[model samples]
Target chain A: MNLTAEEKGILQGAQGKGMQLALSTLVRYGEAFAADRMVEIHSAHLAGSFGAFIYRTYYDAIRLMVKEGLKVKVPATLNPRPLEKIKFLDRIMISQQGFLEASLAKLGVTPNYSCVCYDRENIPPQGAMLAWAESSAVQFANSVLGARTNRNSVTIDLCSAVTGKTPRFGYLLDQNRRGQVLVKVKAKKIDFPALGFLLGKKVVNRVPVLEHLECTRDDLKNMGAAMAASGAVALFHIEGVTPEAPTMKDIFDREPDEIITITEEELASLRSFEKSKPEMVVFGCPHLTMSEVKTLGEFYRGKQVKLPTYFCMIPRVRQELGGTDLLRDLEAAGVRVTAQCPLAAWTIRALGRKTILTNSGKLYYYLHKSEYGATEDCLKFSGVSS
Target chain B: MKELQGRGIISGQATGKALVTSQPLNLTSGLSKPWNLFNRLAAVYYDRHHELYKKDLYNRVLVFPQTIGSTFTGMVILETIRRGRAPLAMVVQQADTLLTSGLILAEVWLHKKVPLIEVPDPQLFNLIKTNDLVEVNGDTGAIRIIG
Candidate 1:
């Protein structure tokens, strides 16, 4: 890869050992992909913050960097941990969380603790380059916001955050971002998450451009998250919806490589709920935005929940909604509002086996069979159980 | 003996029993016991694949099409290696950055080696089956099947 003189200097150990190590790691990563150059990144969002005890090495590695006095050059945000300080963890979990917190604190990273860092922490300008690690966030940044980024891994994001640079390849190149397949939406009411799940399975790493569908920002967010979970899709174009692609022609330079239409039946087929009663209902796999929380509050007003329900959001969003009448009403309805990442929280063995109902397709895909019970979405999950 | 060539993501050499799968593995949840704390065994909860669920991944040749689920997969790979439970080498139909980043971290920080090679050939999967002894040359991008 072509490196600037400064990058070469850092590589030559002109900078600290931490910087040298960071650049060397990135260079190897870039070489694996045959990347020829490095691009400046506007911002970065890192994962691996949960510090789950099994990942002690990750914490130790970061701690070494911190001890070496290496700091992030660009604005950086962290992914949510299992809990902030709920105090239910055993001795081992507590120790792991402590190590993770200390390492991040020493690095001076923002305590955003959100997968949706683009929404709350830092919103890059259109076409701005980024090095973001969270799957859903990377897809949203690339597909919805028109910003460029690859589905960076946790360590790569850390390196990019410190260096403010990433290898210029894959999604960073315009050629790889063009729509490879054309998908038409034929459903009356768009199930954004299901649509995303379907698109991801169909495309499998190829970029798809949606046609003849109108979707909101939140709709795109849900769709992108599910797509990233089900497939390796980093970026997608929705004609007349997303920023970059105003029309089908704008997304694809020529006729799309292939075309697929999504019918109402196809969308319906994606929903398969076998559980009769749900032990828990969860929302916000991508972390709820303020508007989503408000809408949920309005929907459940004066209605008592039959099962335990949890509303997960980032700390900032929780703070914004705290002490509000909406929050109070939801809490009164027996809804538990916490900033914990449900994905990580469910992994706790203490939770045990229980059927979980959620609105997030990504959550459904991950936790369906592994947790010893079925996982379904709220809409269908509500019909059969409640 | 059969040999296949592709791009090499990490450079090293090793031979181990092969465990091949057509489905993508979610290394983060598939190979982790973060909740168990004291349990050093990874992926004890991964039930998606009956063949791999709760199976030992330590020093085996993990063969798969690609990786799916979670950006934390890279971190999981690193942790698995740190616990001495990582695959001896990885052979994938298509190489992804999420898996390679972990191997890269191991090499850079820990001086440990877990070579990865991509064999995009469709027949490559048909040729290499579970329990087959396979040798990998990451620097040369070669995979030799030896009985």
Candidate 2:
């Protein structure tokens, strides 16, 4: 990998054990993606699920690391979940109390109710390297910030932070970030969530180039959220939308690999709403933002989701709602103001092996194609259980 | 098969189950409580009820792109590890998640250390199986399933 002498020295443990572990992890991650070397990340973002597993595994690590005197130096922020509360509530649930909490104390991670971590912290220099994990963050960083990062997992984000490098792969490579398949939109201004649902359903397990629509950073953020919720698109290439698409010719890292068009009718079929009474209207597969909830609340006033609906917004965002009495209004209207994500709490409760209603394509696809094959629809409705 | 091998990471030599996944996991929403509980309550649920979760039935090898989700997942994994209920070792496609945190903690705090192989090869899938004795080489990003 392209490493400066100082970086090489750090990799060789001249920096310290923490830096050594971090560098080693980065080197390995880069090699896995077939990248030869590392790149420096201007900023870092901490990630955690709002469930029990995080307490069990990572919580313990942070505790031990803190006890050992490890710390993060670069300016870093957190994803939009409340880790402290989960730690406090579940502390007694496990036999080892101080084990995980101490580690978190050491890491100094914040529960800064924000999804746009780089924007929130105002970190990541223009065209800088990054190691963010959240899909929307990845999309925004690569497409908006002109910053470089391969779509990474939670584990490697730290590695990049510690080592100050990431493998040059996926979105980091100029050749890899280009638009592969072309996607056309028929709607005048494609609704953000529906656009994501349509894109995900059409490009299940594959990459495609998006076209025929005007989108802003906000619109793309919404698209990223919906795409992650409805399908498995960790990264997406939008023509004239993402940073890579400054021009049509530049849309493809190579010549246009392929193209696909989307229509309103095709978008409609993706919803799959059932005819019978709906069971639930679930939101926040990628986890809802306060702005989204507030927007929805305006339409949903005095009306229940017309079915049982669960919404899991970011904990920090939930805190904002608490001050505004939004939670009270939401709950009084019969909606659960969930601070934690349901998908993150897969170990807490079962959604049953039954068909569920949701506007999220990512959740629908995951549940529908899950082991039990629970049926799902975009339109509000019910179906016979298997 | 051109094989690569290293010591097991999370569970020690578990045999009889195999599931390989290289898809990256986002912890914030992908893994949750009841699912972790489900993983504990119903072993068979891995296959029929929770395919999104890598099943460890029949044989005992679980491969992932990497461990994702929360740090607390390490504890649940440790609980399963203490009970001998988890897979033999975790072959992570990458090396960044709480998987390493859990392994380090089990080794240090809990005094239970399991091998966690960080192999980054996208092609490691070709050489592993549900019933084969596999070694994970985190150093080289490869896996060798012993016949």
Candidate 3:
């Protein structure tokens, strides 16, 4: 791959050893993808802060870089960390969280611990290039917002954060962004998350254009997250819905590479389990938006939760909803508002196992096998007898 | 011995018994249950294939279609390698940037090399079988099937 004189200088340690290492790693990574050159990235959202405790090597690497006086050159934000004041955390987990927070501070990353950083912290313009790592966030940026980003890995995202550039290949380029599959949605009552799960399974690694589906931005967000979870799809265009494709013709070139039709039965079949008694109910997998939080608050206000219900949100969103009656109502209903990812938090081993009921297709897909029992949709557990 | 050509994502060499899967592997969740908690010994495969559910991935050549699910694939691969429970090498039908990034970080941080090569040919999957002694040269993108 061709590099600019400045890139060459950085590789040669003209900038610093930390930069040389970072550039070298990125150059190797780019070569693996056959990227011709580097593209300047508008922003970066890293995935390192959350799970750094499980993998000490990641924490050590960041600490070393910080000790070398290296900091991110571009605007960057971190994924969610464990809630600092949570009572359930053990001593070891607490220390690990503190260690990660300090390391991130040294690296100059904004403490905006959100998987949905695109929602508020860094909303890139349509077609703007980015280096974001979280799968759901990557899907949201690419499919819903029309910004361009690959499903970048965690370490590679950090490299891009330091350099403000990423390999100019894959989803970053225009030719690779066209829809290859046509998915006709025949389901009248569109379960956005289930549709996304089914669509992802149908079109693995190929971009799909949805037909006859009208969806809101929040619906698209849930759909994109499920799709990315169930399949390797980084981007999808909804006909006349998403920003990129205003019409069917706008998404496909001459003809769609393939076509698949999804029926109501097919979407229904995507649900993993029918009914089960739930020990816990989880709401947010990609972190809840402000609207979602409000809606949940209203729904569960007077009703008492039969089980331990956890509503996960980013710190920013939680802060925005602070001092409102909605927050008070949620707290009164025995709902614990958290800033940490439930998926990552469960890795603590000490958290133990419980039958979890979640509305998130992404969460259900990942945890169904491991947990005692994971059922789709919290409504299934809502009216169940305790 | 039959040689198959592929694109090398991570450069290295290894010879090991092969573990082939027809389905895509979700490196994050498929490897084990949540209760395992990064313990390679207790790690159990949670895919549809029940035969390989409890099989060990350590020092074996893992051949699969592609990686599915989670951007945390890189981190999972890194942790598996860190625990010395990773496959000796990997051969995929297509290049996966998420998986490759983990191998790259493992190479850099752990000073360990696990060759990863992608064979785009559909027939290659049919040609290789389980427990075949395969020699992988990631630098040259060659897989020698030694029977």
Q: Best candidate per TM-score, number?
A: 3
Candidate 1: tens digits of C-alpha lDDT, residues B5-123: 87878889999999887777777656655432356644343655446776676678889888876788887787677777678999999888788888898898788889999988887
Point out where model 3 deviates above 4 Å. Answer: A51-53, A83-95, A272-275, A349-352, A369-377, A383-386, B32-44, B48-51
- DockQ of all candidates, in order? 0.68, 0.14, 0.66
Model 3 agreement with the true structure over A1-386: per-residue lDDT tens digits: 99999999999989887777678878878888899999899999898765434666677677778888888877888888745554544445545677777877888888899888877888989999999998888998998889999988877788888888898888988888998999888877888888877777878788998885776677888888889988999999988888889988888887988889888887777554445555778778878888888766777776677778888897888898789888888888788888888776654433456767676778777765332222235644653331
Rank order (by TM-score, best first): 3, 1, 2
Question: TM-scores across all candidates?
Answer: 0.92, 0.68, 0.93
Recovered fraction of real interface contacts per model:
0.77, 0.07, 0.62
Interface Cα RMSD, each model: 1.6, 6.4, 1.5
> After TM-score superposition, what is the CA distance of residue A329 in candidate 2 from its true location, in Å?
5.8
Report lDDT (Cα) of residue B9, candidate 3. 82
lDDT of 2: 0.53
> Predicted candidate 3: what Cα RMSD to the true structure?
2.8
Q: Please report the TM-score between candidate 2 and the true structure.
A: 0.68
Query: Between prediction 1 and prediction 2, which has the larger TM-score?
Result: 1
- Enumerate clash totals for all models, in the order shown: 1, 61, 0
- For model 3 the local lDDT of residue A259 reads 82
After superposing candidate 2 on the true structure, give the runs of residues whose Cα lies further than 4 Å from its correct spot: A2-16, A49-57, A82-106, A114-126, A162-164, A186-207, A216-219, A226-232, A263-266, A272-279, A301-311, A314-338, A345-347, A351-356, A365-386, B1-147
